[model samples]
Target: MQSIQIETEYVTLGQFLKMIDVIGSGGLAKWYLEEYQVYVNGEIEQRRGRKLKPGDQIEIPDVGKFEIIE
Candidate 1:
């Protein structure tokens, strides 16, 4: 598992994905989100606008695991 430090109260899933290079761009993130299975705190999340806060864990199967940090 890896940690992603956020300087705000929350970060949108798309923004986080782009910041961490999961997707090349916002548009790609939006498109690819539907194609891939993303989990937050062990629940499948398909919304690109899903709000992720500190301590939230995101897992992308076969890709990697990441945790949000303040």
Candidate 2:
């Protein structure tokens, strides 16, 4: 899994996507979420506002796996 370092207590899914270059802009988060399946902590997640903290795991098929770190 790829490690994503976060400087804050948590980051929103939309923000994370941008941090990883998954989306070019925050505005694309909604469209991306609707078009793809994002798994968070082993559960399907669709909310762009979902808060993700350190140790959280995120999986996107074809995109790869990632883990949040402090």
Candidate 3:
């Protein structure tokens, strides 16, 4: 699994995607969510505003696995 560090208390799923280089801009979060399957802690997630904090795990099939860290 890959680790992503954040300085804030939390990061929105949209911001996380950008941090991981999955999307070019925050505006594409909606489209990306619709086009791809994003799993948050084993459950499917599609909200761009979903808050992701430290210890959270994200899995994107065919893409990669990620973990949020402080």
Candidate 4:
């Protein structure tokens, strides 16, 4: 599990990806999302713009898992 530091109420999957620099840009996120390489709460998430709140867990399969934190 991993934690992401944030000073906001919540973060979207797209924003989180950007904050973590996982992908180069929004375009890349979209491509990856279309490929279904992203997962949320143990399920494949094809929506790059999925909203994520504290306590939400995101799993990127071979990549890794990101646990939202306060």
Candidate 1 per-residue lDDT, tens place, 1-70, comes to 9999999999999998999888998888778788999999999898889999999999999889999999
Tens-digit lDDT track of model 3 for 1-70: 9999999999999999998899999999999999999999999999999999999999999889999999
Note each model's CA RMSD in angstroms: 0.8, 0.5, 0.5, 1.4
lDDT of all the models against the reference?
A: 0.92, 0.98, 0.97, 0.80
What are the models' TM-scores? 0.93, 0.97, 0.97, 0.84
Model 2: pairs clashing at backbone N, Cα or C within 3 Å: none
Q: For model 1, what is the error of residue 16's alpha carbon versus the real structure, in angstroms, after optimal superposition?
A: 1.0
Candidate 4 per-residue C-alpha lDDT over 1-70 given as tens digits, one digit per residue, 9 for 90 to 100: 8887677788878888877778787777887777757778878877777888888898886777888888
3 or 4, greater by lDDT: 3
The predicted structure with the larger lDDT, 1 or 2, is 2
Shift in Å, residue 42, candidate 2: 0.6
| 1-70: candidate 2 lDDT, tens digit per residue | 9999999999999999999999999999999999999999999999999999999999999999999999
Worst 10 residues of 3 by lDDT: 14-23
Worst 10 residues of 2 by lDDT: 13-22
User: How does model 4 fare in lDDT?
Assistant: 0.80
Rank ordering of all candidates by lDDT, starting from the highest: 2, 3, 1, 4
Task: Supply the TM-score for candidate 2.
Answer: 0.97
**Stretches of model 3 off by over 4 angstroms after superposition:** none
lDDT of 1 at 57: 99
